[model samples]
Target: MDVAEGPSSSSVVSEQTIEAGHTLLLKMPTGDVRPHKIEKDTTVNLGKFGSFHANHLIGQPYGLTYDIVDKSLKVVPPRPIQEVEDTEATNELINDGEFVQPLTSEEIEELKKQGLPADEIVKRQIEQHANYQLKTEYSKEKYKKRKVAKYSKGFSTVIPALYNVCEYWFNKDATRLRDIRPDALSQILNLASIRPGGRYLCVDDASGIVVTGILQRLAGEGRLITICDIESPPAYPCMVQMNFPKEHTAVISSLNWATADEDYTPIVASSEPPTGKFKSEGQKSRLNKRKVASDMLMRHREELFAGEFDGLVIASQYDPWSILERLYPYLGGSASIVVHSPQVQILSDLHAKLRDLPGYLGPSLTEGFLRRYQVLPGRTHPTMNTSGTGGFILHAIKVYDDPNASSVMAHRQKAKKAKLEAEANANAAPATSSAEPERPVSDETLAETTQPIESSDAAMES
Candidate 1:
């Protein structure tokens, strides 16, 4: 199947065609979202909602709601009102103890077995409910919604943007993706300066989540070299679901962590090709596989050795410094390096180390706190039981050694020392009293002045 190429780096903000090989989030009638890869001519079973041919969804616009009607596909009409207004709120709620429906589970099963239409089945159940009249309009709407979620055979297709993909994994298996929330991932991407046509070296141990985020930002424009162990190749289930074209995915190259820096001495290139005379079929197949592995190793290792990648992004279990120390040399001058860890201490230690290093600048540690809210008009408030932290990130940039920087730094140190000394001197100096000093009269001047004042007083008395 010929999958369409994804939008360019600048054009992906808009919607595109839903083609085969594209990863899409299927929103079930019950509001459950599942990420699925669109393979051509495949059957997708939505369990109780029944199954549909994958081809039935091809060419449909994303966010289009589809319904399975009488074993055929149909587009669900858009609702006139997208949301229930706060004015529609009602106080009545059906108690869980109340089983208002007259139909038993067996009767519902019997109706389902008769191949009755889903809507017809739901309508029957609603009509049979004992509290059907007691329900307020809002309660009735809620009841119908609950029933539709169970009996409806429909789904909404959503374009799985990076945020959607992350949310899906977070809801499904957060531990698998290292709990790197979408907001945290965004910070990493922005701090790392991920851009189109830039080459990046990455350590993705978060089930390829980090890899996917980097790839999406690059938008099929640059090479993203990933470091992986031989035992576990960087296989992200999320990435497999994305419908990115072969060329876009080809930009993500992997190098074995152990042999990332090793010279690619191609043993396969030196070995003679297997001959029919000496090789059995099985042996020949093994030889071909070995050659393929060798070639792949050589290709990735050559790229690893090539001068300076644009950035380094690591999300791994190993010590961030250990990984950085090994890969730091390969980063270009002024390249952004971002390390993410769930534990704060690891990043704290890394920050202390990187900040003092000559080749790096401002290794600041930061974390993201996301608080979700129920955004209803009248009763909007923060959602209960929401996760507070995605993870912690350590962001820094690689720097080149500058001989003149030492002198500049020395000058700054001297200026700082002088300023400090000047402050100390000012503080140490004693305060002088501003009051007028008493003038001491000399003995002769004081006697003459007193004698004149006394003569003037005597004359005045006479």
Candidate 2:
């Protein structure tokens, strides 16, 4: 069987519409998003709202809203949210009861069975509502929105970019991502200075949320070496969910912490040809797999040992200081180092530790707080609920640690102290020495006495 290759450079650049096997997000009318992989001739099930054939979405541009009509999808313009104005209507006489809507469950189900459109069903319910008219304009709008959220059979296509993936995972299970919000992840990328063609070292224990962000920013360029656990392979469920193309994922290389040590030797693949045929096809396949794994491991080990990474980004369960101690040497001079942790205390401790360490500068501990807002016209305000704390980030820069420079600075400080001491001693002796006739010092003697000190100071300064 022939295997398919990844998109070419031009295609990758120009491709915008959804394609078969592309993973995309579906944002339902209820403001819920679901990840879906497009497959031809398959049906995508959206519970309560309905299901639609996946082919209808294929080749379609993203951000288009589709309404299910007779089990088929049709592009529909999004509902416009009108600016609600103040009105005299009040809820004083309005009764809040289950019977406020005259439409019964049986009737609604019957309407659904009859294949009535969601909009039509909602309109009928509104007409039958007992207190909808008695409420204010804002309340009426809110009521309609609630009904729409429940009955609307429409969804919009969303691109599974880094932001979208982070948001989806965060909303679904924030703990799974170590509570790293989208804003926090963005900050990490910025602090680490992640860019194309730059090599980065990452220790992501947040199920690949950090790794995914790094790779997405790399955009199919540069290298990302992630450290994983010794026992198991790196688990990047979040990255896998993004469904990146082969070229984009090709830059990622991973090795276990145990193998990252200098003393650990990776098994290299033999260059010699095979001497005999395999006993069976399965045996040959297994042997080939082993060879491939061995070669990849060796290559990754070499890439890591050959240091000078552009940046280091870590979101791990291990002690941040320990990780920094082990991987600090790999970072290039002036390389950005960013460590993310769910607990601020840990990062705060790390921040203080980095301050006293050589070669680390401007260590800062920061926590990101993200609050969403409802941007509706004439009703703009912060959302009722917001995420508490994403996480804390400890950022610092790694510089060249020159032993000679440090020694020279120390000598200069020592010489300056000695000079101050000698001046003090001379000032005390001057009063006693003034009583006797002091012999005039010759120019050559004075120059010789001070020349050594001046030369030494200049050498230390230089």
Candidate 3:
């Protein structure tokens, strides 16, 4: 992040060591404005205006514009560029590291509200790296002359939590998680059948892991019933209380009955104080058996045996059949939303449970392993094989409201219809004019149409 720059303040087109993404926000003497995205090994073009060596841009000053001179950007000797690092641009920025997300809900909604297709909105966010900020710095300038030149203008705001979701999901390593669009989210939720006003639950045994993205998605939709064990005073990530919309939140405490107001369900737990390590398969099995027993022993765990949610997010060690053993029955066919991650134990548990269920929608959980969702860092590489983009996410929903539920089939039909509608928009497209001229058919077409059928007599003659 060290940026060294111009020999002196008056120097025009002086070089600075510009890190990729660290923009040179500046006003130049000649009034040529540019926000240069630092690139490695590539020379930039300013046209008859001028160009500069990518390395030279590293140490440029903020609020100072570099004028293009005689078709090339001016260069100053190796002036030490002061390294600039914004925590907002580092730890907090979505897609700066593992995975990526660039667009915001408000931004996508604005595009949709403005009549953009979900795909187009997503494409735009990806291509232009657009986010929730409405006014581009270019848009903020008083004069139109500089608006295009000084394109940094936009509706700027703090880095958002959903941006993280986009990062993890897309793993593009962009300065923004560019592809997390409303339409895609709408598809995912609708596909999961997370109805408005219906309760959504997330078991946050993973702490500040991948579940944050899932919870954020649910919270964005509407009513949510978040389930988590209070290993600490407040189990859920503080990001929710701080970032999620308040009216959409509903706090449900399901803890020990010995404690007051224990109206609850034991949605999460660990067998051996949830240690982070298990050296061998035997050790893993022993701990798992104890985990299963503990998870099962939780007071009236069977009360949650039936499926009861529009959606459910469970993270940490997937107990395979063990976790679902207590939860699937409660799904009672109403479980339209379910998501999990690489917690192998949970996948194993769910895989077994689905085998018993009438209609389980999943790839073969019996064989192979979970695929790591890949991600790209917005910045350059620290080294190869290490990615900011890569992880796992498993999703499902139980449609059976009854053990003998024939209605599950009906539910699926409706769900398919809803997905089709959401995905394949049925709105009218621009029409072709009746007066438009048409091209004539070719002679080959006429010959093909004119070819005679062979009767028995014609065959004999031939």
Candidate 4:
């Protein structure tokens, strides 16, 4: 096993430790998923399934599947069980569910009110079923899955990957995310050439979906400057849910585009001391937070004016061309620019504008077409419902804008002319006599030459 390199100061949850405040993906036995923020000193209630102390999850490795066990319903690894036998005898026992042991709603409610263990309740229900012994091993497995979905008190902790979060948001509300599907987001990352150690300028108006997606590629190793035009920073609901470490989150610098050209200083402390001792602790805490926020703002401003960015990504409601026209100047040579929009007309106009622009290469518009398939034995086909459009994307690379455009073009023409002339000279010149003796060194050649030490020393000795 390999040892951990070191610890990071950011509050983001690492793979090894699920700390408090970290958002996790809790998957139910029914294949349903939901996001749960790990609050300190509180119980995470999963409704009918059960509840576990938030502290119970802290310090646990991510992606570990835990089963709710015992009276208090503590989380623990599931106990190993024997695999089901798939014999012909068991297959012959399959029964249709037309009529079975019918239990009234009140009876089921009474069983639940008794607080009986889920396994015990399931066993009792199976025993009461009229066709209990008639189920094939496969049928029994299917029955168990249904019961587990209804009564199991267990969940698996999943690392909230950017892709997963995007997928979750797509499921939750595609419209809010600008209709950016997971596959579409993947294409955006690819087209933008997002990677570690890159400096990116982003217009993340989609609640930090683009920001978090970029961070996944950066992997806590790059700079992200998010430009917004608002009084308060845009609420990155999705990014906050990811709980990126303060250090990694530190990489993301937010700036108001209105003041991006202006310089400002951070307020270190209040000029006037507390007027009275009546100020509560909450007020003092709020003051300190403001100071910290001011300092962060100053830092982000410093970085924004520092240098050109490696890439520009926009997933905003603003006109893509307008945003790019203003920001394209800040992109370094060969920098990629990617714009995502649900409508085709926006990209179509942007494509025309980019073509007219001088310092862009291959400004093309592309669409991400995705279709999922359901694969199972004897039941494999394209899923019935698929997103009609993942959205249109525009990609282009920045190029050096030559100050002397005419001069540069003239120079290229002259060089080509020189090359052709030289080739003509080589071909038209009289063939060199291969048998011609080499030319003897003339006075000009001898004047430029330095005799070897061996010959000079012999001459001097003589």
lDDT of each: 0.75, 0.82, 0.42, 0.74
| lDDT of each residue in 1-462, candidate 3, tens digit only | 435762556432222223454433222323333334456667765443345566655454422334343323443234343332323322233333332335566775576456453346655655654432333332222122332232221211112334433333343232222222323333434545554455445454444332345445445455443344443234544243123444334423242222212354435455453467777788789888977755644532333332365565454343534444444444535465344443345556555556455545442332222233423233333344433322233455465333443343445556776777799876433333222123334568777778775667759788
Q: List residue ranges in candidate 4 displaced over 4 A.
A: 1-14, 70-101, 115-144, 261-307, 371-389, 401-462
User: 1 or 2, which is superior by lDDT?
Assistant: 2
Instruction: Provide TM-scores for the models.
Output: 0.74, 0.82, 0.34, 0.68
lDDT of 1 by residue, 207-272 (tens): 788888888878779888888776446676767555665666877877676668564343345223
Model 1 score (lDDT): 0.75
lDDT of 2 by residue, 1-462 (tens): 344664456665434578898878889988898888789999988988899888888888777888887668989976687878879998788766743667888999899888787768889998887777788888777877787678788798876678888999999998988889999999999999999998999999998999999888898999999998865567798986577778888899888888888887755655333777677777777788878888878778888989999999989889988998889988899999999898988888887778776689778888887778899877889999888879988888998765454343345556766786787753221122121223444678777776656457658888
Task: Please list all clashing residue pairs in model 1, or write none if there are none.
Answer: 21-243, 22-243, 23-243
lDDT of 4 by residue, 258-353 (tens): 645444444346622378452777777777787677667776776776658999999889988778766776788899999988889988988877
lDDT accuracy of residue 39 in candidate 1:
88
RMSD of each: 17.7, 12.4, 25.8, 14.8
Q: On TM-score, who's better, 1 or 2?
A: 2
Most accurate candidate by lDDT: 2
Candidate 4, 422: how far from true, in Å? 26
**Lowest lDDT 10-mer window, candidate 1?**
428-437
